[model samples]
Target: MSQRVIAPKSRGFLFLDSHPGGCRRLVEEMWRAVPDPAPAGGEGPVALVIGSSAGYGLAATIAGLARVGIRGIGVCFEKAPGRRTGTAGWYRTAATARLAREHGRDMVFLNGDAFGDAVKEQVAGLLTERFGGKLDFLVYSVAAPRRTDPETGTVHSSVLRPIGSPHTTKTLVFDEHGAPEVKEITTAPAEGDDIEQTVAVMGGADWERWVTFLDGRSLLAEGFTTAALSYIGSPLTAAIYRQGTIGAAKSHLEATARTLDERLAKTLGGRAVTSVNAAAVTQSSTAIPGIALYAGLLRGVLGDAMVAPVGQLTQLWDRLTGARPLDPDDEGRVRLDTWELDPAVRKAVAERWSGATSGTVAELADLDWFGDEVRRLYGFSVPGIDYGAAVETDVPWPSAGA
Candidate 1:
């Protein structure tokens, strides 16, 4: 990695590398100096959050702790530590721990594979030893390609291909020029095992592990609620997500919710809800083969209708905590993306896609927003940053598949 800290490229072309995830650490710390609220007349209920790192996890963590004032433990299943120019979740976790400890707020951070048995046991112990053997709420939001079972010792790897007939499409990918242009591609349908494996990884196995563990230890509370996050990718991403191995996992995941709900309801009147958030470019979203084009279209076509995710997080946080309160639907997913299927938004973006003539992924992706999101994902989107400033030291670079 280069020692020189280039004042991070911002705006226009080079936006994918915007580094928004890095902001998590800073946001956590800033919440600290504000003083803690009293528990009796205090802020909100205490909670434990899994996947409280970058993307949705980080936002959910911040919104609960900061915006809605719910002090809690964040269980992040990723590698590394400390907040820096890179490693969005690591930095964010470090910052949250600091604030939480200072306020006498109980918070524990576990950086490991969520699928492992040891991980499951460690979390169970945390609940038993710390939070009085009761968790008022649980949020399971994990997106990973692989999982290892604790007992059966089975491993699952996900796939991404549509079912039915073999499908082929064109994708815009990066080249030596640091620009993206469309190219032809072919994708095959997933085999039966492929679907099962995908379900094992993306499905509700891990979710069931946590909930069952809680129930076994008798740590579950009455009227307790849990939710799993899911995405149904568009027609464009069907080959890589919906129709692919991952979709199979999601199907399993959707089913897991029902099973989990059945188990939980037998005890504390618990229910497992599913929240299907609209598509936005998180780290996971950006890596897909053809969705960049869909994201690009989302950008150009949505206009001001586009919801900057941080803003959306604020709303989501409120809904989740009942801070301000909300009205529920049949399945219990707060419909944030209710308007996503709106005829106007999709129709406009479709027209833009038809007229697209550029080799740049930015144009197809609502480049300005996409690029901004890329930056914000890493915590580099603060307003009034002096572009000319230089750092005197080198720092660890963010690693995706590192």
Candidate 2:
């Protein structure tokens, strides 16, 4: 385990390597941001968090353990360190396990392909034996570019293209000076089976399958509650995001939520709903077209109104645990993006968006903060961590089968 000033290795937005110490620091900060855990509710409330390594999934896991005193099972796909550093999510999960133990909470972390049948079976077995065979809460937050269907053995990849005509919008891109600049970029419409593949990969199929499998085994507890994290961008990004292929996938997910709710309500009196969360700097969000600029301008316009991932999920725990009643929008979905979609906030962001240029974008948007946050996601540019000091790259994940 050797580490010394792990430099940024990136091709565009994708980070190739991560810093263990900095990633641990990131998770520790998330743990600190939420309320401390009450005494563990013994055999009372257990949660299953799919895709629980980064972004909203990771935050939901931390919130479940800290805010709701839940013992949880977290499923993620992350690589271990070898010649190069591991992924940021890997180090974050390791740190999260440590924090859970410190808080007297038990967490089972599984590292593998969560979309496959093997991992799902393993999770079911663990819940049956280790968790009294009942799951109280489930959070499905998987964001992947591609997925191999477990039943059919077919691979599906998600696309970020628009549905109908080409959509041109002001987007942020890197200039020759390695700085961000606003440019008008047009994305072509999806062709062939692009929309179908995107829906197959990102839609609610997997979420529905997970629920059905668990219910088949009689693992869903009475009054069981589930929330799948989702996002509905504003009109600024409507063409590329909200009305795009990914948008179709989100619609399918919401439809699945309604169907699952009906099924659960009739059988176990449980409910499943999609939580439309606020936009933030996440590993997946940064890769989406127009989202980076939207997030940057949003930070500048909304300022203190912008909520972090941890805060959003903490509120989710409140709703799931009965501390707060489940508030759904007209579409029967939990709308956490209300602040981001506020009329005042939208007007300000749109004004800045229309007037933003390569020269004036710095004045209109919080690009600096956005860049720093993106870097911090990969375990670089983190505060209080000595980047020059040696740290362990091969950190041990303290869980069986991880």
What is the TM-score of each predicted model, taking all chains together? 0.81, 0.97
Candidate maximizing lDDT: 2
Deviating ranges (above 4 Å) for candidate 2: 40-44
Task: Please list the Cα RMSD from the true structure of every candidate, rounded to 1 decimal place.
Answer: 5.6, 1.5
Over 132-245, each residue of candidate 1 has an lDDT whose tens digit, in order, gives: 677777777888777777778888787777777677765655565546566666887877788788778888888888888777888777767777777774655666787677
Query: How does residue 173 of candidate 1 score in lDDT?
Result: 56
Residue 50 of model 1 has an lDDT of 75
Which regions of candidate 1 deviate over 4 angstroms?
1-43, 81-86, 98-105, 323-332, 359-365, 379-402
Local distance difference test, each candidate: 0.63, 0.88
lDDT of 2 by residue, 293-386 (tens): 8899999997776889999999988988888989887676998888999998899999998888889889999888888888889898889988
Query: What value does the lDDT take at residue 127 in candidate 2?
Result: 93
The residue-level lDDT of candidate 1 at 402 comes to: 6
